[model samples]
Target: SDKPNTIETDDSRLDRIEEMITNPNERIRTLENIIINQKPDILNLKIKNRVHERKFWRVSQILGRSSQTMATKVVGSYANDLKNSKIQEKHEVLVKKKRLLEGSMVTTPVPTQKAVTAFYAYMSKSENIPGTHHTLIFDTAITNENNGYHPFSGIFIAPEKGIYVFSFSIRLECHSYGPYELVKNSQVVGVVFSDIRQVCLQDQITGTMVITANKGDDIYVRTHATTSHIGLIPSDDNGRSSFAGWLILN
Candidate 1:
């Protein structure tokens, strides 16, 4: 009886041990299954997060481009406004000057005889020379009052303050080219050029301008410094090359 009781106790303890081990093994298998079933959901969540991040960056880039475009438009509008303001200011100044001149003309008396008016000149001979800033001499005089035009020096001294109409004509000889400028008080006022490189005989160029002059202002034509070739064709009777001017208003 004592042996049987000991054997029964040992069997009970072994049964308890086996139950504990089996229970833990079943729990572990269930947990592993749960984790395996959730793998697709976890991957989906990660993909969604990456897509949202890309969309955020794309929206940020669009907003940045829009901001830059708006800034450029603002700058352009401001520049246009500034240019218009400057133009308006210039127009207002010119209007004021015109009004002042009109008032002065009303107070001034009209003279019976005009001021020093008649002056004209022309070149009579052909010339072919290369020079820098060389003055052109006009040997033929059509009408010169008060000896205002000096033929030797190729300069015209204004006799009185007035508005004058000036004209110049230049003829280039065959295979030659010349560029000339009309100068007033050492300032360039107009330009004339002639090129006979492609022509069989000659090529002519003419320029004219109306300018206001002060007394003693030096006016003349000179060969341009940048011109490569120099030759002028002139005829005494044909007046192919000439420089002439006359007073128009006082």
Candidate 2:
């Protein structure tokens, strides 16, 4: 019995050994296959980590750009508000200045003249009356307003441009005869004859005329050209030689 048991045990052990030898390194090969199957998972994990890092970096860049943009907008809004406030202050100042100017005096143009050519003149002496176109001078200006009639020069210069009325009276002794003419700008305007012949014996004659005179025209009284004028013009008690003029708008 002991012999049989020992032979059976040896056979069984030999058979088991032979089976293990035939399928060599089975456990080690199974472990190697499992490691190979897990290779894709490991690679995927590494790729996921890289993607998360890139996503984190992109989010950080966006936040930095957003912060800078927000700061710039704030500064721009503040600048705009300051500029608008300054403009409003300037407008208010301008309005105040305008009000002050309105309260001040409204300045006007300088004054002007309306009357200048009203005058009268007369001779204050007895004068001999005989000449050829002799200018008779009235040395005294009674009412020479603007002195348009120069009493010394015996010339009435028109003070303003318009029509003017002029008149003159001349005296002569009896039997003295001559034609006195009012000369205007080298032209005879009118005539008055004072011939105190024995027929009428007039002491004086008067001449009146109207003329459109410029501002600087000349007017005077004179004897007619080369006429027989011989007399003493007695101006003391007999009569007076007078010249007067006034203006009328044309």
Candidate 3:
């Protein structure tokens, strides 16, 4: 007789499937545990990113300061180089003049005999600020006996060949310095310097010189090429700048 096959019923099959599948509550619990375990690692990653950002900014700031320092040094060096170049150029000009003198090409002016007792002129005011090598106008003439001194041009045009004595005073305002030279025929013969060291302090500097002058020779005061940007040094009621001259021989 054939053994009766064990009948596979639907209820038995369903019972086996239920055993194989996990419960929904157990799956939810497993997901929760996985998220909880990874939370600290996520927080550590965020913290590390912030630290890296801070370090990058710090390094950038340091580099910025270094670049600024380098730029300052470069600018200062360039300015110094320019100053040296000017000095060298001035030296070259002096050497050339010295060479010309050594060649005996220049002749001395003959001294004039005594003629006029004195051709005297004096001025009290500086009309305007003069530029480099520009004549300073003495607009207000106190006395011009021989009329050799011209207030409009600030020049003493020699009425006749003679030896002349010239004097000048320069007074600058507070916090100012003005250095001017006595010029004869486009040559600097003397210098007068004035400086106000303290604020609100003002003073005057004066110079005197005697020189042989040819007829129609121009004599005046002028500023140096290195004068301040203000150009003309101003004089107020605090002090006065003056110019005076007298012919010693004519």
Candidate 4:
């Protein structure tokens, strides 16, 4: 079994002293002063008439003080400096990222297989076909004005509109003086190269011409000299004109 002990206070002694004093009891004030500890130095008080409130002023004016100084002092303040810097950096980064995204969106992507196939088909359809291996010979013997030898004559017409490539080889046994030329629609397209040893006018002379022609166009190979014999078609050995190969239109 244990008994509780009580602690004594000086409140009775303090009350007795207050009763003897004529002036109002200053004990509560003194006790309050002691508890508060700090004294306001009123003699050293400064009257600050600046736009912002002082630090010692009431907290109610803090918002006003902050507002007043915000334009000038806030930029260098510790918390606001870092916060503003970070905010600006984030804004710049976001702007740069947005610009990069916009740039990427502007570029066109590679075409798909279907798109490429369609483009190729369109190009092929639009392009004209190229002509190949066309030959035309004329009968020169029909005129008979220049010796017994006949000259080559006649125009070969194209059935379809296309690019045409033609070649000719001419051989003469008796007359070396006569001239031969390959023509397209009566226009001279090519001539025999007499200077080249391989293309001399002795046994055979060959020439080539490439032209783009329309449908139903006439092309011919003609000779300057004339003869009674039709020299366009192949004759049996004696200066007879003859035509050969795939010259007939289908």
- The most accurate candidate by lDDT is 2
Taking all chains together, the TM-score of candidate 4 against the true structure is: 0.29
Mind sharing the TM-score for model 1?
Answer: 0.52
Residue runs of model 3 more than 4 Å from their true location after superposition: 1-130, 197-199, 229-232, 235-238
- Measured against the true structure, the TM-scores of the candidates, in listed sequence, are 0.52, 0.53, 0.47, 0.29
- Model 3 sits at a Cα RMSD from the real structure of 27.9
Residue-level lDDT of model 3, residues 71-123, one tens digit each, is 89999999999999999999999999898787655465556654442333334
lDDT of 4 at 204: 49
By the lDDT metric, which is better: model 3 or model 4? 3
For each of the candidates, the C-alpha root-mean-square deviation to the true structure, in angstroms, is 23.2, 18.3, 27.9, 20.3
lDDT of each: 0.82, 0.83, 0.74, 0.45
- The candidate scoring highest on TM-score is 2
- Model 2, position 94, has a per-residue lDDT of 99
Between candidates 3 and 4, the TM-score winner: 3
Winner on TM-score (1 vs 2) = 2
Q: How well does candidate 2 match the true structure, expressed as C-alpha RMSD?
A: 18.3
Looking at model 3, the pairs that clash are none
Clashing pairs in 1: none
lDDT of 3: 0.74
Total clashes for model 1: 0
